[model samples]
Target: MNTTLFDRVSAVQADLLVTFVPSEGAFPESTAWVDGNADGQLSQLRESGVFKGGLAQTLLLPSITQDFAQPVLLVGIGKDAELSDMQARKVIAAVAAQIKSLPYASVALASRALVLKKRTQSEVTALIAQWLNEGFYNFLGFKQDDAEKATKVTDLLIEGDDEAALAIGTATANGSAFARQLGNLPGNVCTPNYLASKAQHFGEEYGIDVELLDETKMDELGMHCLLSVGRGSDQPSYLIVMHYRGGEEGEAPHVLLGKGITFDTGGISLKPGPKMDEMKYDMCGAASVFGTMKAICELKPKLNFTAVVAAAENMPSARATKPGDIVKTMSGKTVEVLNTDAEGRLVLCDALTYIERFKPKSVVDVATLTGACVVALGSVNSGMYANDDAVAESLKAASQISADKIWQMPLNEEYQQQLDSNFADIGNIGGPEAGSVTAACFLSRFTASYPWAHLDIAGVAWSGGAAKGATGRPVALLTRYLLDKAS
Candidate 1:
C-alpha cells in the first residue's frame, strides 16, 4: 500500500475522500474542498435527523465536484471533545472496514478531522496508519482457493504535512501485519526452523546481525531448561538472536527475550482436547518481537537492541519432559517441572539467563505465559511485571500513548515462597493461587542481573470463535517504548 501526505486536501485526487463531522460542531476545514449541495449533505442529513456523527458512525455521499470522480465519506468523531488515540483507531478501523470491500483505487483522509487530545499530529497519524494497515491485513497464505482473496488499498493519502509520521505509522502497521501473519499460520508451517529462517532473512535484509544456536550448541551451553521443552517435538529448538547496533559503540543494548513455543501441546502434562488447536498462538510473543524488530529496522531507531527468541515446539511424546523432572538452566538454577504446561517460562528462563552475557541495560521478556494472566487482565490488557518501578512506569507511559493497554502485576518477594521445591531450586508451578504472579516470580529469579519486565500476553495474543485470529498486540507498546527511548 502506498501512504503519503499532502498539504491541502483539495489538491489531492482520489476515488474516495474522507472527512469527519462532530455531533455538536460543523464539518472540519478539510471538507472545504466539497462544493455545492454535496458539501451540505452532512448538514442536510443532520437536519433531517439522519446523521448524528456519533463515534464510529459514518455516512457516504456522492461527490458533486468535477475535480474528483468519487464520493465523500463523513465519519463521526463523537461530541466536540478531544480525540484519544483509541478513539481514532476505532474510527479509522471502522472507516477502513467500510471501504475495504469497495472498488476504490485510492482514498484521501483529511487529517484535520482527527482532533488531538493529549497527542500530537504525528502520533495520531501513526496510529491512523497502523489501524488502517492492520485492518487491511488478510491471512490467506494457506488458502488455495481464490474464494477469499484479499483486495489491497492501492493508495492512501493522508491530508497533512507530516510525512515522517506517515512513514512511522506505515512501518509500525507493517510490523503488526507481519506478526499477525506469523501468528495466524499453522504450527506445521511456522515451526522453530521457519522462525529461525525468518530471523535470518530479516537480519540479512535489514543489516542486523543474526545468530542461530542449534540444539547441539544449546546442549553445550547447558540451556537444558529451554532444550527440555522441545525434546518431545520432531522439530528442533533453537535460540534465535537479532542484533541491531544503531547507537554508538559499546552502548548497552535493550534486550528483548521472547518465548517461541511454536506449537504447545502441554508436553507430558497434556492439555484438554478442546481449543487445543489455538495453542498455535503460543508463539505470538516471539511473533510480536519479530514485528517490533521489523518496525525498528525500517524506522532505523538510533538505539542498540537485541531480540532473542527461544524457539521451540512443546509436544507430548515418549521423549517429552515428564512432571517432577528436574532441569538445569543456563543460570545454574535447577527447576522442578511440576506441570509441563508451564513450559514458556522454562524456555524464557534460559534465554533470559543467556542474555546476561551482553550486560544489557534492561531486559524485557514477552510470552503467552499463563492462563492466570488471562483471568486477571482478560483480553483487554496485557499483564506486565517489572522488577523496577521506573521500568514499569515507562511501559505504562508507552501504553498510555500507544493505546495498547497493560496492567502492572505485583512481583513481591512473597510470591517466591510458592516456587520452592524439595528436589530443585524452584518449581515451575506454584500451586494454583496467584498463578500469574508466581510465573513472573519464576522468571524473575533469572533476571536479577538487570531491570527486567515481563509481558504475559496469553489473553491478548489472539481472539477466539468466529473472528479468531492473532491481535498482534503489545508490539505497539514495545515500539512506542523503543521510540521514546530513542528520542
Candidate 2:
C-alpha cells in the first residue's frame, strides 16, 4: 500500500473521498466543495436523520453529479472538545471497517477536518495512517479461496504536508503487520529455529548483525534454566540476537528481551486439551521484538539497540524437566521448578543474566508470562512492572503517545517471599497469590544491574473465540519509545 499527502482538498483525486464531521456543529469547511458538488446531499442526510455525525457514525452517499467524487463517506468524530488521540483512532477504525471490502482502489481523507483536543495536526495525521493500516490487516495465509485473498485499497491520500509523520505511521504499521504474520502461524511451523532464521533474514535485509546460540552453546554458557524449558520437545531452542547500530560508536545500547516459547504445552505439567491451539501465540513477545526492529531499521533512528529472544518449545515427554527439578541459570543462581508451566520466567531469567555482557543502558523485556495479568488487566491493557520508576514513566509516556494501553503493577519486595524455595535459591512458581507480581519479582532478581521494565502482555497479545489472532501490541509502544529517545 502507498500513502501520499496532499496539502489541499481541491487537489485530491481518488476513487472515494472521506470527510469527518463533528456532532455538535455544521460540517467542516473542507467538505464544502464536496457538498456543493453533490447538490447538498450531506446536508440532506443530516436533515433526514440518516447521519447525525455521532461518535463513530458513518454515512455513505453515491455520486449525484459528475464533478463530485463518487461515494463520499462522512464519519462522525463527535464534538471538537471531546476529541482525543484514542477517539481519533477509533474513528479511523470505523472508517477502515466501512471501506475495507468496498471495490475502491484509492481513497482520500480530509485530514484538516479532524480537530483533536491537545493534539497537533501531525499527530492526528500519523494516527490516521497508523490505524487505517492496522484496520485493513487480515491474515489470509491459510485461506484457500482466491476471493478471500484479494486486495482492498492500494493507495491512500491524506490532506496534509507532514510526510515525516506519515512515514512513521506507515513504518509502524508495516512492523506490526510483520509481527502479526509471525504470531498467526501454526506452532509447528513457527518454531525456535524458524524464529532464528527470521531474525537472520531481517538482519540481512536491514543491514543489522545477527547471531544465534544453539542449545549446546547455551549449555556451555550455563543457561541451563532456559535450556530446560525446551528439553521436552524434539525441536531445538535458540538464543537469537540482533544488533542495530544507528548511534555513535561505544554508546550504551538499549536492550530488548522477548520470551519466545513458540508453543507451550506446559511440559510435564500438561495444560488442558481445550483451546491448546491458541498456544501458538506464545511467541508474540518475540514477534514484537522483530516488528520493532524492522521499524527501527526503516526509520534509521540515531540510537544503538539490541534485541534478544529466548526461543523454545515446551511439551510433555520423557526428557521434559519435571516438577521439583533444580537448574542453575547463567547468573549461577539456582531455581527449583515447582511447575513446568511457569517456564517463561525460567527462559527470561537466563536471557536477562546473559545480556549483562552488553552493559546496556536500560532493558525492557516483553512476555506472555502469566494468566494473572489477564485476570487483573483483561485484554484492554498490558500489565507493566519495572525496577526503576524513571523507566516506568518513560514507557507510560510512550504508551500514551502510541495508544497502546499499559497499567503498572506493584513490584514491591513483599511479593519476593512468594518465590522462596526450600531446595534452591528461588522457585519458578510463586504460591497462588499475586502471580503476576511474583513473576515480575523473579525477573527482577536478574535485572538488578540496569534500569529494567517488564511488560506482561499475556492479555493483549492475542484474542480468543471468534477473533482468535495476534494483536501485535506493544510494537507501537516500543517503537514510539525508541523514536522519542532518538529524537
Candidate 3:
C-alpha cells in the first residue's frame, strides 16, 4: 500500500484521529464531532452507542446536503494512563480493516505514539510504521490464485512529517512483503534445497556469505537425528549457514538457529484435516530468520553474526522414521521417537548441536514447534523459554521496545524428566501435559552447553484473519535486540 506523511491534520476527504485520555476520562475530539446522546463530548458519542472506548466508528458517506470539511473519525484510545503501544497499533489496524471494503483511496492517520522509556525517536517511528501496514497483509496465494482482488486501500498516509516515521513504514512494508513471500510460497519451493538457494540469494544481494551442507554432507557429520526426520521425503534436507561480518573481521559472531520444516505431514503420524495445505508455512521460522538477516543488513549493525537453518520436509512413507524408532543426534544424544508428529524437536536438536561447531558467543533458535504453545500464548504473545537470564532479560527488553512481546515460561528440571526414555537417552515428546514446556525442556538440553534462548512461535507465526497476511514478521523483535547488544 502507498503511504504518505503530513505534518498534522490535513484538509482531505477522510480523517482518522487517535487520542489518549486518563482512566474514566470523558471522550474528547480535536475537531467537530457528532454526539449520539446530543451530549457535548465523545463519552456522549459512546452513550449514543456510536463508539466504544478505543475503537473505530465509520461515518457513512456524507449526504449531499451535509456540511463537512472531511469525514471525521474520532478513535478513542481509552485513558492516557492506560495507553500502550499495542493499543495504538490495534487502533490503526481497526481503521485500516474498515477501509478494506471501501473504494481505493488515500486515508490519512492522525496519530502519535508515546516515547516510553526514552526510546530513540527513529526506533519508535520505525516500529509503529511497520505494525500499521502489517495489519493490511494476508496470504491469498492458496485461495484459487486470485490476483484481481484489489486492495481496499491503495496507500496509507501517516499524520506526521517525521522522516523517521516514513522510513519506519517503508522498512516495515518491505519486511511484511518479504514475510508474505515466504509465508505464501508452496512448501515444495521452500524445501531445504530451496532455502539454501534462498540463503545464496541473500549473500549475492546483500554481500552475506552463505554455506550449504547437503544430506550427504550432513550424514558424514553424524546428523542422524536431523536426517531421520527428512529421510522419508523425496526432497533432500540440508543445513543452511549464513555469515554476516558487519563488524571488524574475526569478531565473535552471535549465532541464530531456525527450524526450517518446510512441510510436516507428521511423517508416520500423518495429519488429517482439511486445509492441511497451509502446512507450507512450517518453514516460516526459517523464513523469518532469512528476513531478519536481510533487515539487519538494511539496518546495518556494527556487530557480526552467523545463522544456522535446519531445513527439511517430513513426509510419511516406507522410508519415513516411525514411532518407537531411535536415532542419535549430532550432540551424541539418543532420541526415541514416541510419536512421529513430534518432529520439530528432532530437527532443532541437530541444528542446535550444529551451532556448537561455530562456537558462537551466544545462541537463539526460532521455531513453530508446538500446538501447546498456541494454547498457552494464543495469537498475541510468542512462548519464550531460555536457559540464561541475562539473554532472556535483553530479549524481553527488546520485545517491549519493538512491540513484539514474548512471555517467558519456566524451563525447570522437572519438565526435562518427561522426555527421559527407558530405552533411549531421551524421548522426542513428553507426556501430553505441558507439551510446550516439555519441548522447551528438550531444546534446553542441547542449549545447556551455551548461552541460549528458544522462542516457540506456534502462535505468533501466523496472525490468522486478524491481520491482512497470516505472517507477522516476528524477527523485528530480535533484530532490535541483537542491534542493542552488539552496538
User: How much does each candidate deviate from the true structure in C-alpha RMSD?
Assistant: 1.7, 1.4, 4.6
> What's the TM-score of each model vs. the native?
0.96, 0.97, 0.82
The CA lDDT at 329 in model 1 is: 93
Residue pairs with clashing backbones, model 2: none
* Candidate 2 displacement at residue 345 in angstroms: 0.4
Q: Which window of ten consecutive residues has the lowest lDDT sum in model 1?
A: 31-40
Q: Which stretches of candidate 3 lie over 4 Å from their true place?
A: 1-5, 8-54, 60-82, 99-107, 113-124, 140-145, 150-157, 161-169, 463-469
Clashes of each: 0, 0, 10
Question: Who is ahead in TM-score, 1 or 3?
Answer: 1
Ranking by TM-score: 2, 1, 3
Q: Which is the winner by TM-score between candidate 2 and candidate 3?
A: 2
Residue-wise lDDT of candidate 2 within 121-158, one digit each (tens)? 78777777888888888886677774554657999998
Q: What C-alpha lDDT values do all the predictions have?
A: 0.88, 0.90, 0.73
On residues 418-460, what C-alpha lDDT tens digit does candidate 3 reach at each position? 8889999999999989999999999888876779999988888
Clashing pairs in 1: none
